[model samples]
Target: MEPALDDIWREVHLDGLKPVLPLFPTDALSEQSDESELLPDYAESDMNSAISALSGRHCVKLENLSISFGSVHKQPSWTMDPTALLDVLRQNPSLKTVTLRLPIPAVTVIEELGDLSRLERLEMRWWKDPGDTGTTGDGTTSMELFPSLRNIRSGKLSTFRRILSYMSTHLITWLKITVSSFSETQELFNMIQPCSALKSIHIMPIVPLAPTISDPLDLTLSFQPILKCKAMENFFIHTLNTVPPSDSDLTSLAVAWPKLSTFTWSSLSRYGPQATLEGLKTLSANCRSLRKLDIPIQVPPELPKQTPHAPFCDGVTVDIRQWRVDDAVDIDRFVGYLAPLAPRDGTPWLRLGNVKAGVWIAVGDRLRQCYD
Candidate 1:
């Protein structure tokens, strides 16, 4: 499968993942990979040297490993022959999950990796090194690579999208993807539209190659695409780069995925209008099977009018962490509004209560006081 122009594989170095020492320059991390002539994480060694290190590993049988190599200032000397890498993988047939960050055309890498008979999960990222080589459909064909693959956690859109096209979508049940742009988000939804069997998807905003969180995404338009995967249950987004979702966005999400039990999107922007109590009431009315709710919403000032007609989901922990409160708020008023979400009696044995402190701890304290 031919990847898009932007998703080139840069580096996948498995440097034994040894952390650099205290004397390592912290300043190199903040600089973009291209700008940093010699990244602190990479030892100024060549590809043969990296592979030799892997050859000397302590484990005779390997299960999972992540190896990547790339930099903007990559020299002509930073060469890799996938033949050597392929030989190494051939030795370790027990490898079930393999993460590669390499500076080569994905076509060459995937074609070479077709020999790996037992790899089940693949994590691939393009590191933007000078080593990549390909033209349109150059030097590769549609050979079924990673035959046993199921789970895929890709850092680049092209990497995941290309893999999905080759594999049987029905086989994949879980996905943890990091999308860097809105176009990437919408495009990914199109890819998952056919993933009817996908049970859980964890979406993240930070790009693996860069140090910064991507530009803010408006949830209204951005989230509409993935609603096609009706089988989703544990829906989560590490939405640090997103504009705090409006109430409409919240309810639309709730109504779309009725099966969601462990729903969470923590650390929203402190500024902007937050999702309010009324919005949450609508959420409770629509999606009743909630077990853990962890969004930042405005807690009401007084006893919220929880009518007899209101939908209540006891045996749940609404981990609305550290919410913004104004005025002298009575604790009872807060608990009354949140009674529908209180933990059911005898449910503490599960220990599903949130560990986050600040506002939610006090509210969780009230759940035992007023509802229990």
Candidate 2:
């Protein structure tokens, strides 16, 4: 062994210099075990780089694939031809899930998605530059791109409607979309008419960060159509407006979706829509199956002088109050009120404070100072 030391060192050095292996090897690397090592993708690479890696491995079956561009937005040089990506997808017939975060070509990409015959789930985020022509006021209206995208951040309401129209026949069970305008809200209601297969719906504002459009979110009217989907089990809506749904609307929700186990509704503006304690009580009484609640509601300033009663339902596991760190008093009130109402076995969490093991007040104080 001492005489062969030079040869052993040469073999070890040579192994390190070998070319990098592709992601999915056709043959087993070792006979003892079949585990594969995690190979890192080049951080700066684009879709073309990915295609090149898998070019010859057409028979490789990927159960799940995720691709995200490292850059925040795509440059002109980085854009990949949409058809080329489709061509790669065609080769992977066994793909069951795909998640993409890239700037894809227009409407043509949506049609090409049909090529993934075995796909059961898809999540995509289209990157855009504020200066891009496609994002201009006139651009989205002229040509509808991202047909599978049900969510809209900023675009003509008509364009969103057209996009939904294209997806009417797809078998989608979960959906999340953003509505920016009141007119768009109406159109969204119309578009949701055909999606009877929906089991969970999450509605978020299109421009939640900077809302350029000002329209009262008519939640009552917008939500009426969603109630028709009897299969619904979970519903969440975030309205960046100043108007909260009224008690009647809350009652209607409880009546419409009695089977809902989780429900969340929030408002972006501080002065805008908030549910009353009465509305919360009504919600608890009606939605018998509700186990989780994330609502922007104002708790009573003082705990009721009367001894608190058990929550209307078996015991709500989650009651998320949208209290921010700016107001310590509001945070105090929310925790003081809900801690007692929570079931002994249930877990309660505050949006801005921690009430676990009776340390919520201290948590609130710390958060308030941090914000200040």
Candidate 2 per-residue lDDT over residues 1-372, each given as its tens digit: 232211111100001112432243223323422222322243344346554544334544455555555433333345555655676566666666665556565345444655555666665555333333322122224333333333222223333343443444234467666666655565666566556666777766555544434565567666677677766778877766545666677787778777777887766754543576567677777778777777666666575543555554775654554654444455555555555454444434334433343446555554353334
Model 1: runs farther than 4 Å from truth?
Answer: 1-14, 19-47, 53-63, 68-81, 90-94, 102-105, 129-144, 207-216, 240-255, 270-289, 300-314, 322-336, 344-369
For model 1, residues 186-217, the per-residue Cα lDDT tens digits are 66776776677677888877543232345556
Candidate 2: C-alpha lDDT: 0.53
Alpha-carbon RMSD, candidate 1: 11.3
Clashes of each: 20, 3
Give me the candidate number with maximum lDDT.
Answer: 1
Model 2, residue 366: C-alpha shift (Å): 20
**lDDT, candidate 2, at 235:** 80
TM-score of each: 0.65, 0.67
